[model samples]
Target chain A: MEKLRLGALEAGGTKMVCAIGDENGTIYEQVSIPTTTPKETIPKMIAYFRDKGIDALGIACFGPIELDRDSEKYGYITTTPKLAWRDCDIVGQMQEALHCPVGFDTDVNGSVLGEVTFGQAQGKKCVMYLTIGTGVGGGIYSNGELHHGMLHPETGHVLITKRTADTYAGRCPYHKNCLEGLAAGPAIEERWGRKAVDLADCPEVWELEADYIAQALTGYVMTVSPEMIILGGGVMHQEQLFPLIRKKLKEYINGYIVTDELADMEHYVVPASLHDDQGIMGCLELARRALENDH
Target chain B: MEKLRLGALEAGGTKMVCAIGDENGTIYEQVSIPTTTPKETIPKMIAYFRDKGIDALGIACFGPIELDRDSEKYGYITTTPKLAWRDCDIVGQMQEALHCPVGFDTDVNGSVLGEVTFGQAQGKKCVMYLTIGTGVGGGIYSNGELHHGMLHPETGHVLITKRTADTYAGRCPYHKNCLEGLAAGPAIEERWGRKAVDLADCPEVWELEADYIAQALTGYVMTVSPEMIILGGGVMHQEQLFPLIRKKLKEYINGYIVTDELADMEHYVVPASLHDDQGIMGCLELARRALENDH
Candidate 1:
């Protein structure tokens, strides 16, 4: 029996990471490319995977990707913050360049898949993965499958509860006072007039950030009811936010549904175990699933 | 082939309705009982179903119910506003009394299932069903299945983005200013010092209600990104609120994600097709599904 060889790609707004891995997600080779125009970035990505000699490829990209159930253009990147990638044939380009079967989904979805298959949420029937980075993104898994619908889940843009005394107009172009507008990286930068990293030492910023996040999590808990909520991405790297989020969730939940797990606090809300590799590993897992279905 | 015999129960805070139906959700016989203590109500419900010769029963009840997957007490009504039914073994009682299989879930979940199976969301993979009654409740459907998790999705209790200059303490015990606290029927009554029906003649109340609802819906849209949203329940009887909510949604969403479906405001956000029967019929559908799985 031969081991499954797969290629994984995590395409974000700022960078692209490509890796070659076995079925178990053991990366043999990898490369990172700063995101540029599709013409330049796509070619470089193709070149990296081409020399890797893999059998299948997967992509986890920032989206609103056009997903058609019956069409080969299923995984094409349709809309993205990256100016050059809008309406670009991402899956088609990869298939044409790499000459292999390809699987694709949003980075959050891929990250969730990776977690479900090999990380924190492994063996969990239902889970939600949220990445709070340049922007907020989320993926939901129910009954052991990634939730896909008319479009991907975009939880980050949800509205946040505003405090009476605080008045920040918000930074999201789409929604002036939505969660992203109030708490995303750009929103924090605009509100504080400094980068998030610079404010890591500021207790007030983290306190406010945790409040917004905990409020959003309350909504997610009330709506999705996932057994575990895996929080990831650059913003979540701030270790202090975790305890504050849990405390706020407890205060907000109000003992409505008492669970021994949530009573423990450590069990209900936790950080993503895979860290950064979850997306790429999830891509590889998707590629494997796609290949299995094909055969 | 024997036609599957199914029973449906729609358990509202104020009333309990039981109906016998076929696989197509056509009601054969129906009965209504005022919601009272569980000990008093359970026996009447059991006798009614037993006399009707039901093969299986489905229950759609208000939450927060204890849906512990690992416990036999999964569908017990844990904490509901109906104080008389607290800590009651809802599903177990039904199953024991009637001597048949049972399917149990939240009323909102049943409503979404009804919409997905027989209403406006017939062909859609993801749909959100929101019932604005004494309190606001929502059921999320993704990939043709109702979403369930740690407990159940309690979307109504989620906090909302405060929009108005007026400061009225919300009614919800969990979050004083949550969406349900601010926009539910009781909230309207509390805010205006009159019943929602009495205030229907006043456009000022409806305008504020619409603003709050639109803010909550905006959060829902950004978080869930469902293909279609179906609004139902008693408060929605005021047809004027629909247009107000739609207009507010457009104003809140801006033009971030351009979809022709959403571009046409009238088509995307609309009323639920089944009206009051959604919950009962959905319970019938759930019963049918449980019977199929049993076989």
Candidate 2:
């Protein structure tokens, strides 16, 4: 199993990052392909994996994927803003071309799986990975598996209470002042009239940002009860946000769940240790799991 | 399995309802014992099961009971309000005396398991059972099992936004305006200066109650993505609240998740069909499962 070859694809709207890896999370070969259309993009993927001669492929795809394993459209990416890829049969095409088992899930779920398998959440049974960049999306990993139900958790859209001092009209078109609208990087820029990286010097700006992230974490904590929570993406580069979010998370939790993880804020909620490698590494794990489950 | 005799105990603060049943959820003998102290109460349970000749036992106990089966205090009723039974070893004593595989869980969790196995949520893969009673508590059953991470889900204590139209200060001493504080039976009684049963005629009261329940349900739906949601408990007895909650849940979800279950509100959000038998029936299923898992 450790020596088995796996193909990892971090499928995105802009591009796809493909890597030939192993069950042990080592990447042997990698390539990036531009995403144009199904015809243009999928052939490039098939060519990459075919050349690699992989045992299995794992796709950390940009979704609204049909995650229901029993669904006829199980591998089709439905209703994505990437109009060209909408309703595209990504997994089916890859599986047919590569002639191997394929595991597919949302990118965020992949990142969490990566973290859980080999990164920050190494030994944790229950964990959540949240990416707060242009949008707020998250993945749930619990009982040594990624969560997929009606769909992978639409975490960003969960409604949250807004602060009294904030007057900014939230940017999310769907639900205004939702966790994503109030806390994501774009929300920070819209709220402070400056980018999050630039607004770091202003202490109050981060305080509010941490407040929203913490509130969202509280909801996730109550629902998923993750053993550890990892925060990633561009906005978390501030470093100051880590302590602030952890503190506010404990405050919001209000001592209901009395455990070492909840009491010790310093280590419970932290940054994604894999840095930029979370997706590719997670995809590799997914590939490994798909191969194992297939057999 | 259907021929095996099982013991079901609905352990409450005021009384303990013990029943001798089988895998088919048929109760042959039953009795109510006053919950005075372990000395008086537990012997009655042992006596009941000893005579019944059961193969397994299930205790649907009032909690903060130790749900963590691996912990040293696995079956101890920890920090309960019933003064004498704070740390009562209910499961341990029952297992020792009756000498059968004893299953134990919180009453709410048991009710949900009951629904999932033999009642409303039968054949459903993912479901949430929320009881908006003296307090708003819930149980989650997904992937054909009860969810117990960190602890069973403490659904009632979650934070929700205050509706702009209402200005009632919430009653929960822990979190001021959490779901339990805002929408529980006591909250309604406090707000209207009457019991829930007395206030059923007021259409607006039920509307507001439905709105708050809908808000909490929205959070659950987003996180759990349950296939069906069952509403039970005393406050839900107000039959008018069902249609109102279903309508409001759809409105709050706002078509974010497109599914047959979400589209059909009438059949999706429903009342418990088993009526007063939810606890005992769930316990029977629990006993049956414990025996199966044990073997």
Candidate 3:
């Protein structure tokens, strides 16, 4: 089979990364555009790939993006924090402009797919990916497919135990102290009055941050029982948070359920290996799958 | 295809419920045997099923049972608090004695499968079944198959926030404040100085108990995003606990992820429609699957 040119887009809250890749996920051309509004951003993304001769486009977008194929708004970005993109039919617009098949999913889901296809989670049956950036979100690859049900796995919105000493009230608009509210990048900045990167030396900051993340990870471990949990995004860049999270996970789970993966904590929970390219590569994989299915 | 006779067993901590059924999960005859030492109990179960012309046997036993087929201890009950049956090779023994294909999983998983196949969750793609009996065990049917990884989901041990006024350390031997520790029948008994049945009228007791359950269910809903959650077991029999749980679920989730199921409340979270027969009938379905797979 001839290798087909593919288009990949990693649409974030701040910017959109548009790339021309191939069936093998190798990028041939890529560009970034500021996410001013759907009207402006979607057109720029489509124009970048218009002459790329791609057979299909795959989007790993900041969501809640509608992925339900049966819905009329299936390819539209639904109620997201990025107010400008809400209700924007990014996939439909791209398909109309490029006249090619398109695939769409949450950015976190794309990351997990990227890891499963090309990074640390390769060959793993049950894999989980979590991004703790401006917000907390997770993607699950379970039973050899990206898991989706009524919605998606809303790991960030799940409640977590609040630390008794800290009373900062969380930053999330919805659940005040949910995993996202307490542990996301903005949550840390708001709680401690500084960005996570600047607070690396403060044990108090990372300790509480790690505590919240570990608490949420414990929930993931117990419920999803993923073979590996990959943590990424801005906050996880703090190297010390990993050990604290590993320790807290052990403390929380308390050996009630045992597995070699849990015992070897180092392998069970680790930072994402794909780095920033996960979303783009994952989008390429999704595009590959779409084309393969079409065939 | 000729219908095959199937044998189903629900091995509980106190007693073993044994039944002879068919592929359709219809019981031809059923009996109960007290759970004793494996030497005595295994022989009695074997004696009952012998010469029954069963094509397959499914054992939905009290666990933590090893379910990984590649492991040396695949069918053995491992490290269960039920000391008499710990490390017992229930499925291997059954297969050896009956000379037929054997299916084995946690009793909770069996119940979920039963519900999916023959009860309330029929035709549903994503479903969760939780048993809050002597212990708080759960099973998930996600993406249209029973979910299992590492070990099957030990959801009972996931941590929950302790209520402010409740000081009792909880009854679980491991993880003192876990979901099972706080909301299991024994947990309620230990916390309130009475069994769940005896404390039926205690609003405070039921309210706190319902709060912990709802918290755990919130985690389940967030992670699994199941179409339905079925609550079963002795603790759920309080009946009043259901409304309290539904109310608390709405509180914890707080509309972060919108779904029609969450809005309805009553339809999304429900009691097991199969009631007491869920585990046995689930075992029968497992037996049926085992026979079907053999073909």
User: DockQ: which candidate is best?
Assistant: 3
* Local accuracy of candidate 3 as per-residue lDDT tens digits, B119-230: 9889888899998888888999887678887889989988898977889988777676789888889888887777678888889988998899999999988888988899
Which rank order by DockQ, best down to worst?
A: 3, 1, 2
Lowest summed lDDT window (length 10), candidate 1 chain B: B253-262
| Residue pairs in collision within model 2 | none
Sliding window of 10 residues with minimal summed lDDT for model 2 chain B: B144-153
Misplaced by over 4 Å in model 1 are: A51-53, A70-73, A164-167
Q: Per-residue error at B126 for model 1, in Å?
A: 0.8
What is the clash count of model 3? 0
Residue A137 Cα positional deviation in candidate 2, in Å, after optimal superposition: 1.5
State each model's CA lDDT, in order: 0.82, 0.84, 0.87
Report residue A75 deviation for candidate 3 (angstroms). 2.5
Per residue, candidate 1 scores C-alpha lDDT tens digits across B192-221 of: 898788777899888888888887777677
Report the lDDT of model 2 for residue A1: 31
Report RMSD (Å) for each prediction in the order shown: 2.0, 1.8, 1.7
Per-residue error for B65 in candidate 2, Å, reads 2.4
